[model samples]
Target chain A: MKPENQTISPNQLFYLVSVFLLGSSVIFLPGAQAGSSAWLAVGLGALEGLIFLAIYNALVRQHPGKNLIEMNELVFGSFLGKVVSWLYLLFFLFVSAMLLRTFASFFAIIMTSTPLMVFLITPLVVSSFAVRSGLEVLARYSQIVLMTLVLLFCLESILLAQDMDPSNLLPFMDIPISEMLLAIQNVAAIPFGEAIVFLIFINLVSAPLEAGRFMRRSFLFSGILLVLYAVRTIAVLGTHSTISTYPAFAAVRIINIGEVFTRLEILLAVVFLSLGFVKGSVFYYGAVLGFSQLLKMRSHTPLILPIGALLLNISTLLFDEYIYDIIDANMLFPLYSMVFAFFLPLLTLIVAKIQKRRIQKGE
Target chain B: MLNVFLVIIAYILVGLFEAPGLIRNKYWRELSIVAVLLSSSLTLSLLLAMGVRLPMIIPVIYRAFVPLLTWLGIM
Candidate 1:
């Protein structure tokens, strides 16, 4: 709550952005994009993300030391501004739910047969506690988790090198151009575009000018890491990557250094849990912060539990009976997110600029 | 069947008790209720229209209130 007490260096901010974006997506993106051409999607997606980040940077520059909610009120009229701010809060909450559900479903499939809700509730409770501690703790926690994830990822990728077939990358770009573009849009909207949530905490950075540099570094680092993982998944699973529901998990399952290095998906699960925890905590924090701003509350700590409970309920309720609904979320939620996260914010920025210009001319 | 409903009830009760402390101002109390109700209704309608079955007990309550609320011209 004390901005002076919260001092996150530019390096830490970079690490937070990298880890938050890289998270669990690297494990599954190859399977989602599939085949030899997934890297093409990654390349295009990174470019789209950079453009989106530019728009965000412009917004940040225009409203130094203000989060999106405050800027919304400054830009739009009170009623419309509150609506937009609330929509963003809802978006953050929905994302938190989706990530929680995904992590839970993954555990249910690979790690345990216990009820998904039981596995999920533990993370939700933990994340609520983490968010209540405030942003500095979350940022520091992300740094530690990101380091562990990177170490484990490098070790796993190396161990799996034997199973990898370079031939799997052959015949690249075979997919239609349109499909590749669609994949780019998907990637942009997801892992890259969703990092727009960082805008909520941009004011917390020790150096605002370095935000662009830190964000770019985070995107490139995460982008490269994801591309490497995708390459590994393709090489290990070959054309079978498309068939496997969780190609990264399957790839990890296939790793065997003369049978001693088998079944390291457990290690991958640790990475997933760490990344998922950071992601959930960040969104949960954002939701609480946005709610506080909307109500003009001094702090969000007391509200954390109720919001966490609401999210827990919404997580369970949001999904349909079939897993296909979850997949449909992959298809639908990204577009919905773009409206609030990118398009709406951009509109607000334009309106703010116009209003400022009008006031200056009147003077 | 009964257990899940009970768990949900417990969750809602926890939320209701905490809500007052979250935003203590009178204006915020009214705003918070409106925000919760409108958002919940919007989500419920959207999910139902998508053909997702609401868990049985929740649907019964929603069905009862939704019509009554709609008839009163309140979302």
Candidate 2:
């Protein structure tokens, strides 16, 4: 594997991964979990996220500078290694497509009446441009976007503070443990667990020793932010949080400070759009890198557009007219994400560790 | 249905523009393009067949938000 000439500071890498992990998905979390216990579910989900970070850190520590693909070859024999690598690559593409669809769906619902295709293609085009420039450019862009998102989040929270009611969070833990576990599972799989893609760029960090520390801090920070926002939504909207399809949007819509400082949903949209872009670009970058490594291409740039086109098509088709049913009932996304993001990576780490022990004994 | 088809056509156009640079020297790019198109088409077809309407609450909330917007001077 060739060494990457460009290096990103630990903080930039931290923001990139943090923003990618925390996107518009956080907005729906309260709705999905519902109940006053939603905060507990998010807390449980954060624990699950820590477990994932542990697995990711273990893998990176073992094979410095090598991605999951290269590590696959090192741990498994060439034949099986290539097969596993291909599966991982497929997972990356599917996730990128999923994120793209989610972004477009949110935009269509809240931001604009423009056709879904327009919303979808805009980010794909922008992502393709970022990929063409390379990973360092994407890192720099993430730094700027993440900072803006944080600022907007703070401003929105401050402005909406008066509308928040403490009574909404009353009777906490009223839900059965079983239902709370289910909600936690949903959050874990969708947002935190799906962060497996960070494995692809762990080696790009300028300070490898700080990788674990940065990941932990960022995950905690984002998790806290998500929890506070979820609390705010529940406090403002009460049980309406579950009834509203997009609780965050509705929460923002309810912000009427003296009637003079309302309709700031557009600000929320901008924040969501920025987070979506970072998420899409990270996934896009990971998929392109996976393909480039798989085919042994000199650079990943050439493949960016072709991949972007395919993602656009997939995004549009993912939730046809029956999208409501998909969101309301289907458990496929959570199940599939857990398999690819959590189980598969954990399995790979186990295999690698076993192989390492064997080699050590032989030596 | 027609709207969905139009969206699909737009995607194809985007793909066509991307093909030249993608095909310069890699089989994975070509393979990915095919996979994306096929999977997306299949998913879209399934979704259209399901024909789920947007829920009523979305618009109700949108209506609710309108006054809030006017108050905020964003409208």
Candidate 3:
């Protein structure tokens, strides 16, 4: 990864971040508790995501050219920094594997006869190639993939418009306030807070100082798109959106435009696969790049496939019924995600600020 | 059993595909890391292919959080 030579444009950053934020969330629909009001939770989650992005950007501004691992070293000293970086490496790997498994399960729905390892290996192989080509390639790919997703999403929604009952969005406060808050927290932690990984790539942007603005814009873009998806799903599927494993796919299946546009669920699958690829490659790139940096290696290229193999192993064996239960347990998932996403980065920022103040006083 | 052979062969092909470049560059450290990662993942994958029940790490993470989430009444 040539960070200095290969700088990501603001638009590339926007597309990458937008696709990543909208990844598995499109299929799984985080914040199921919000029901028809899930769109509101996504809206609020984007607002909260801006605050999270602000903290990440502040960290970047504090250490202009340094990535998360390097910033940890500067702020916490080498030993503690290595420990924190290792934890983040694990987090990234876990996230990569989780995203891989999410899509594999979705694949299983379509290809029931196919073996699990096939689903796991194929994506990892593609993502390994993507990660090996480096971040710029991944960002370039996101632009095309995100555009396709948006177009397919719009076409499907328009086709389903006839079947949509706008009244389905009524009685918005169906869930209790506390549960609604939890649902909002789930939305924030997932697809939104997951943007914390972008901190690692912030310094790779053409103008690191302005990357935050791009990220904020992408968050708003992805948020509005997700809100539209939520509303469309609710409008098409009604209360059944909460129960369907894939509300978007089910709703797309309902798209019967004079039999010409019926059975449009394949469009949803294509959208999910493309979004998952972009998201997976980003996380995959983050893990390998960050680890290589931690190891003081010149290139992360060799590590890509090996780490990909590890991801394959994790995705294949780690995702079962019990793991699904844990992941679907909205309470645990959000709180657990916040530890790596919000808490650690905030702590690093505060400690860095305090250390800088002390140095100024000493000077 | 054949599926396991295919997997092993696939890994071998990947190793063959990548090793020459590393050897040419004399990136011995990278080669070693790649060797470690590939071998470990291969061992785990082969075990999985054979239906060997490997211990999972996620359950430990879940155990750590389950108690806390349960206490919050959000489980």
Each prediction's TM-score against the native?
0.84, 0.82, 0.95
**Candidate 1 share of real interface contacts:** 0.07
Local accuracy of candidate 2 as per-residue lDDT tens digits, B25-52: 4556455745575456545544543564
Encode model 3's per-residue lDDT on A34-55: one tens digit a residue. Answer: 9889889878877887888889
Q: Provide the clashing-pair count of each candidate structure.
A: 0, 3, 0
Worst 10 residues of 3 chain A by lDDT: A322-331
Q: Identify the leading candidate in terms of TM-score.
A: 3
Q: What local lDDT does model 1 show for residue A12?
A: 87
The lDDT-based order of candidates, best leading, equals 3, 1, 2
Which regions of candidate 3 fall more than 4 Å away from where they truly are?
A1-5, A322-329
User: In candidate 1, which residue pairs clash?
Assistant: none
Model 1 lDDT tens row, A1-363? 322236578888888888888776856753255257776677677778888888888888888877787788778878888998888888888788878877888777765658877877899989988886777887888888888888888898888877889988877888767566667777788788788778778877889877878898888888888878888888888878766777787889887887787888888777878887888888888887777768775556556766776777677775544444434444454455678657986798788889889999999
lDDT of 2: 0.72
10 residues in a row with least lDDT, candidate 1 chain A: A321-330
Interface CA RMSD of each prediction in angstroms: 10.9, 10.5, 2.1
Which parts of model 2 are misplaced by more than 4 Å? A1-5, A111-113, A322-330, B1-75
Pairs clashing within candidate 2:
A262-B72, A321-B52, A322-B52
